[model samples]
Target chain A: MNRDGARSSIDVLERYSGETYGRALLGVYLAAPTVWLVSMYAGHAAAGFAAFLVIFAFGLAMDLALRRSSVVLYDERYERISRKASDAVFNVYGGGGFVVFVSLIALEFLGYYEMTPRVETLFLAWSAFVLSWGVCYTAFKSRA
Target chain B: MKNRLPELREREGISQAELAEAVDVTRQTINSIERERYDPSLELAFELATYFDATVEDIFLYEADEDGV
Candidate 1:
């Protein structure tokens, strides 16, 4: 053992600290509503566009904070907390997806949301949920 | 998975915090390693070796029986 008795076999994950993954996830998360907000304000021209810009800036700032806070390799307690949090996030989202899927199937069979926007919302929500969870799983699995 | 990490730590008269700092890791990591729930990377193995002035094998000997755990 080294003087401090730490073994060299432990793998510390330090990958993706750069903004690439964070930006990508943020872009995906913000795209739909930001686009809707922009579209909603399009009739107002400059005022609406300015509002969209402000909202987008706020969204980006939040994203930046999240990315900054996501720095996880330096501290052990933080790492454990992060792992548990990520696992909880994955499980919650996965459960939500399963519930949504079952509901959608039930609705289709029962002819409830056959022609309503409910179906479209389900599709959008499921897509976003799956995509976000996919990224989380990748990030978690890649951690050592 | 079972080894004499605690014994070794006691033998060296080192605290987990001191050992963690010296090894450039968190005390929990050393604790986890001792518990055998996790394995160290080659770099960490080398770090532990260099810290103890011993070979990696001296600190982390592997056993086939332990693998089934």
Candidate 2:
């Protein structure tokens, strides 16, 4: 402990603030749409696979950045709090994803929209769902 | 749950950050505890009690229903 009675070293990495994670998530969202569009234009299954790889790389990069920045150490108490916060965000994301997916399928079935069951389209939709969850989680967690 | 973390920290003349460090938590966690936005776990309650040289009951007050139901 220092003069202030605080611990001298942190045992765990700190969680990034909503602002920081939100910005990184935004970058992923933007890049995902562009990749999907390019793949669609190329009209090749290989192009779709490449798009998936690029998006996966972007997600990996964000994870790495978060870990690198959260070098601050914390104890079990802090870890529990962080875990609960993350769990809440993921729960909401899962529910929202399910609802949107069902709604989309229903719209197609009802003839409200023309749906193509193409592999590329499926990949694009999945990517969009993931990015949207990131955006929502960040926005919700960042609220004052 | 209501706690005396803020009052106790003030009496000790330590910042929330300092208290958090002493308790091995983030400053935000301390702030939330003080504000009653979150409750500490049993292990954490004991840690805080040990740090403040007080019993857990002294720092955290629990009240049952007035009717004792």
Candidate 3:
């Protein structure tokens, strides 16, 4: 390809990759909540498991697509900016989530709110996993 | 930190997109830099200076404190 053609292609790739990543991120949030709601209303363990499988498969596919696209599109500057943005977002999410979780626990202990041990454990595990994923992903992407 | 990015880019006959492409950043980042809403990292500043064939000091102007510290 000519110089201009290559440059344009790179631009297109960057845009496509960014959009795909954004959509995938949004999909995780939407799909998970929708599945949870569906499972809650359906009141069936099988239904919940099925929904979990579907969401997991979708997430895996998106992860693969993002990996492929990012490999082609990311440069040093892009990586640096992405790292900084990701870190900032992760810090806010982690810190805010921790405060909220502690407050909820305190309320539960004080009898102002009620939460089962199982539910509390699930919430903590899921949130910790997400926070760890964000941190790890940023570190991986920022690495040379 | 205030910068003369827009002026320099205009003088060089390049759009924000073009400058962003040359500097390996998003156009939004370039726009933010031009608007003085975002400050570039030292490495990015050096990259911009190198691309414009000028020193970083020539491109970015840092204002002194009112107390003159």
Candidate 4:
């Protein structure tokens, strides 16, 4: 066990099959935005689907390249950095989401704007959270 | 949490990547330890000590708290 009762680095490394799930996650991250953009702007299901497939392929290529070249690990340093990033994200998301929520509601009530489907809007909100967290985590991971 | 890892590793003419590989960690983890930005786990400390043929105390040091002093 580790300092915080987490698994030891050796244990973590040994269990990793060199097939980095992080790379797969990075692939998903890359594909999601392209999916979003194509769906929103292209307005054609076939075009959106094509773009999704292509971008996902590109993401997989990038992932394979990274897996082959880099020695990524889920060591203590990663945990520490991830914790800090999560804390920062929470603060940013709470404040920013509140501001946006209030502004949109105010705009809607005042007849300045129209709201879309609630479920889809909530889905977008969740996507924004994921995007913000990925960006912040990567930024802090590199800098720290 | 301060350590003499960099000096010891340098004296042995070892790269961080090499040490990381030996210790089953990422190179960045070793770099972080050297820079005093991260404290290693007891398991890692012991492993590093064993690798360098030294005690943990020889590598890591605990400073007196300034407030207590």
| lDDT score of residue A70 within candidate 3 | 36
C-alpha displacement of B52 in model 2, angstroms? 1.6
Model-by-model lDDT, in order? 0.66, 0.71, 0.75, 0.75
Query: Model 2, stretches more than 4 Å misplaced?
Result: A1-81, A106-114, A118-144, B64-69
Give the winner by DockQ: 1 or 3: 3
Error of 3 at A58 (Å): 9.2
Q: List the residue pairs that clash in candidate 2.
A: A10-A73, A11-A73, A12-A73, A12-A74
What's model 2's lDDT at B59? Answer: 94
In model 4, residue pairs whose N, Cα or C atoms come closer than 3 Å (at least 3 residues apart or on different chains), thus clashing, are: none
Q: Cα deviation in Å at residue B46, candidate 4? A: 2.1
Q: Across residues B1-69, which tens digit of lDDT does each residue of candidate 3 receive?
A: 799898899999999867876876667678778888788889889999999999999999999989986
Cα lDDT of model 4 by residue, A1-144, tens digit: 455443354344345433355555566767766786778676776777777777777766655544444346456677778989978887787666767777887888999977779934874785688687779889999999
lDDT of 4: 0.75
lDDT of 3 by residue, A1-144 (tens): 897886675555456534345556567858865886788787875787678778877877665555544322344445667889988986777676677778888998899998779868866785976777878879989994
Q: Whose DockQ is greatest here?
A: 3
lDDT of 3 at A85: 95
Q: Is candidate 2 or candidate 4 better by TM-score?
A: 4
Question: Best candidate per TM-score, number?
Answer: 4
DockQ metric, candidate 3: 0.31
List residue ranges in candidate 4 displaced over 4 A: A1-72, A94-144
What is the per-residue lDDT of model 1 for residues A67-116, given as tens digits with 9 covering 90 to 100? 44433224444456688997898778778778877887788899885636
- Candidate 1 lDDT for residue A139: 96
Give the alpha carbon lDDT tens digit for every residue of B1-67 in model 2. Answer: 7889889999999998778767766676788888888788898899999999999999998877799
Compute the interface RMSD for each candidate structure.
Answer: 8.0, 4.6, 4.0, 3.8
